[model samples]
Target: MPLALLALAISAFGIGTTEFVIMGLLPDVAADLHTSVLTAGNLVSAYAIGVVVGAPLLAVVGVRMSRKHLLIVVMGVFVAGNLLSALAPDFGWLVAGRVIAGLPHGAFFGAGSVVAASLAREGREGRAVATVLLGLTFANIVGVPAATLLGQDVGWRATFLVVTGIGVVAVSALAALVPYEPARPQQSLGRELRAFRDRRVLLVLATAVFGFAGVFATYAYLASIATHVMGLEESSVVWVLALCGVGMTIGVAAAGPLTDRAALPTAYAGLGGLAAVLIAFAFTAHITWVAMVMVVLLGAVGFLMTAPLQTMVIRFASDAPTLAAASNHSAFNLANAGGVWLGGVAIASGWGWTSCALVGACLAIVGLVIALTAGQTAARRATA
Candidate 1:
């Protein structure tokens, strides 16, 4: 691996930490802002909206800039957002800060992926992308739990300040390590839009939107599941959270080689695995040890699509990889919003917290069907 990958991974770590750490601190944020947990969750939705809107927006404008410069600019945006969050006066400002912070989240990853893929050896494309995403997986395991604990002790505001500090370090590392490349021939915005017109591209993105949603719906309320459903002390939730992160790290690391060898098949298998795990979780939540194991499984299966989905999108849009790549991030965060909303409705409709797993299961199955259809369609085209 190139040392430049280390820079990108560090930036990914900072970005992922800011993205997920809020989930663990949701209860604290709600209490401090004099609001309900549900309302704090709305802030999460706000951030997702920012990601959905910003990914393509930034990518289109940034198509002409060097990836290194673009990465720096977005990291700057992240730092500024965290600073705003740390200084937020109340619920409204905090929501605004989240939105601001989220605006750069997807664009950074999109650009970083393109850069990482460009840097990889001929047969190792998937490994490079996975290396970048590892930062995100590790953030779940180490960063979120640590930040959550820090928030519980110091204050949620202080936690954002800490994230801001991480962002600063990432910015420095990125500037020093990521080499500059001249901008490639620019694709027109219309050419970029054409990527969306391809049915295969649309299907692949749809799969991500639905498939990824399954996990987010369940994860959106994980804190509730930990404390209210499992009857664990609030402090112990951090360990379970870390355990899930461990599962994600392992799963994503495994996904790289699997994706390099078999992209869509791996995707189908992963989607099926997610559905099975969620279905099992619905029945197992009553047992503490069983539920703990399920958390790891859920994280593992849920993230299996992370690199494959990106690869599939880039494959289809070879003419406009950056735009297609950035748009996939939009797909991901849209799933985040959609899943959170569906999970909230399920819980509010008198379904127990465990029922979110059922919701996730259904979504995963739907995504599996889509992946299978795409694979079959491509096979037919190849045979014909």
Candidate 2:
């Protein structure tokens, strides 16, 4: 891998850390801001909404700009957003700042993925994307726990300040390490929108929604699960989360070569594996050792789908690879929001946090069904 790609991975690490570390610090934020925990939770939702809105918008506007220049600009937006978050006076302002911070999240990954793949040998595309995503996985393992600890001691705002500093480092790295390229031929916003019009692209995105929802259904309430269900102390939750992150890193790393070997079938297998693991997780939660093992497996199997789903979308919409690739992140954010909401409803209705595992399993099965259906359709069309 080029040194430039390494820089992109580092930026991804910073971005992913800021994105998820907030989850661990939500209680601190709620207490400091004098808001209900539910309200503080909306900060996460607000960021997801921003990702949904920003990914396509930024991809369109950025179509004519060099990827390197666009990455720097996006990181600058990220820096400004995190700084605003650190300085926000109220819950509303914090929410606004989170939204601002989120605007570049998807676009950066989309363009960055392209840059990563473009820099690699033709057959190594999966390896390239995996390298960038490794940073994201590692953030969950190392970055979130460290930042969450910092928030617990110093204050949640201090955590945001730390994220701002990470963003600054990323911005500097991107500017210095990533090489410049000329802009692509000008394409109108309408041309970008056309990517959405394709049914295959929509199906692929739906796979992301269902697949990612399965992961988030359990993840959104991970702290609760750890404390309430696993009989672990609050501090121990961090270790459990780190375990999940370890699983994600392993899973994502394995996804690349598997995806290159087999596309949709590999995707279906991953989705099915996630569903099976999640079902086991629900049953295993009563025992800490069993639950811990299941948690790690869940992370690995769930993340294994990332590269395959992303690559599938790009293949299905090969002409608009940038838009399709970027929009996968939006689909993921949608899943993030939807899964949390569904899991919350389950908990509120008296099913308990373990129910989230069951919910996630169902969602994974649904994703598998979609993938299988798409496969059948393709097979029939081939015979015709």
Candidate 3:
């Protein structure tokens, strides 16, 4: 693996920390900003909205720049966002800062995916892409939990400040490590945009959107599930979350190797496992040991779908993948919002928290169906 991959991973660490740390500190942030928890919750939505709006746009804006410079510029935006967040005076400022921080996230990952693919030997692209995703996966285990602890002890502002430092380091690393220029020719804006028109590309993105929805639906209500359903102490929730992160880390690690050999099949296996886990989780929620085991399996199986989905989309895009690649983040964020909204609806309708698992399962089934269609279509095309 290229050392440059490490730089990408490090930046992912900071971005992941800032993105999720807010979830754990919503109450503290709401208190500090003198706003209701609902408003504070909007801060999280603000960041997602930024990613949804910015990923393709920024990829286009940064499209002309060399991949190395674009990555650095993206990191600069991330750093500035965190710095502003650390010093934000009120809720509005904090939301602005988070939006700024999130804007470059998908673009950076998209560009990095392209660069990593270029750097790797033939047939090793999946592993390289998985290596880049490892940063995001690892963040759950290390960055989010650590930041949560820091936020609790000091203040949420300080947590963002720490993330700011991490971003600075990442920027420095990118500057030192990545090549000054990309080896491949740049794709035109029109060419990048055309990728959306491809049937396979659209299907893959849909698969990503619906497939990951299951993960988020169950995940969004986990804290509630822990306290109300499982009867765990509030203090224990963090560690259990951490345990899930451990599963994520493990899943990402295995995904790299498995995806390298069989990309679509790996995704099928992951989606299947994830769907099964989510359904089983609903019933297992009240069982302490079962819940813990299920959480880990859920994390593992959910993230296992990531690298293959990226690989499929990039491949489907063919001549111009940058925008399609970047847009996956948009798809995932949309899934996040959809999953949470549907899960909330379930709970509000007296379906209870466990209903989220079934909702997620249904989503996974939708994704699996799409993937099957995509696979069969590809086979026909290949033989035709």
Error of 2 at 36 (Å): 1.6
Candidate 3 structure quality by residue, lDDT tens digits, 1-384: 689999888988888788877888998898888999887999888899889988998899976778899899999999999999999987889999999999998898888888888788888888888888889878889899899999988999899999999999999999998777752555678888999888888888898899889898988888889999999998777787788888888888888888789888888988899899999999989999999999999999998988888888888887888889999888988888888888888888999889999999999989999988888877787898
Model 2 segments more than 4 A misplaced: 377-384
Per-residue CA lDDT of model 2 for 1-384, tens digit only, reads 698888898888988898998888888999989988878989998899889988888887787788898889888998998999999999899999999999898888888888887887877777778888989999999999999999999998899999899999998999999988887675555666787776667877888899889999998887889999999998898899999999999999998888777878878988999999988888889899999998889889999988787776766665656777889899999999988888778888998789988899899999898888777765675697
lDDT of 1: 0.87
Strongest candidate by lDDT: 3
In model 1, residue pairs whose N, Cα or C atoms come closer than 3 Å (at least 3 residues apart or on different chains), thus clashing, are none
| Pairwise TM-score winner, candidates 2 and 3 | 3
Residues 74-111, candidate 1, lDDT per residue (tens digit)?
Answer: 88999999999999999999998999899887888888
| CA lDDT, candidate 3, residue 324 | 94
Please give the RMSD to the true structure for each candidate, in Å. 1.5, 1.6, 1.2
TM-score to true structure, per model: 0.96, 0.96, 0.98
Worst 10 residues of 3 by lDDT: 178-187
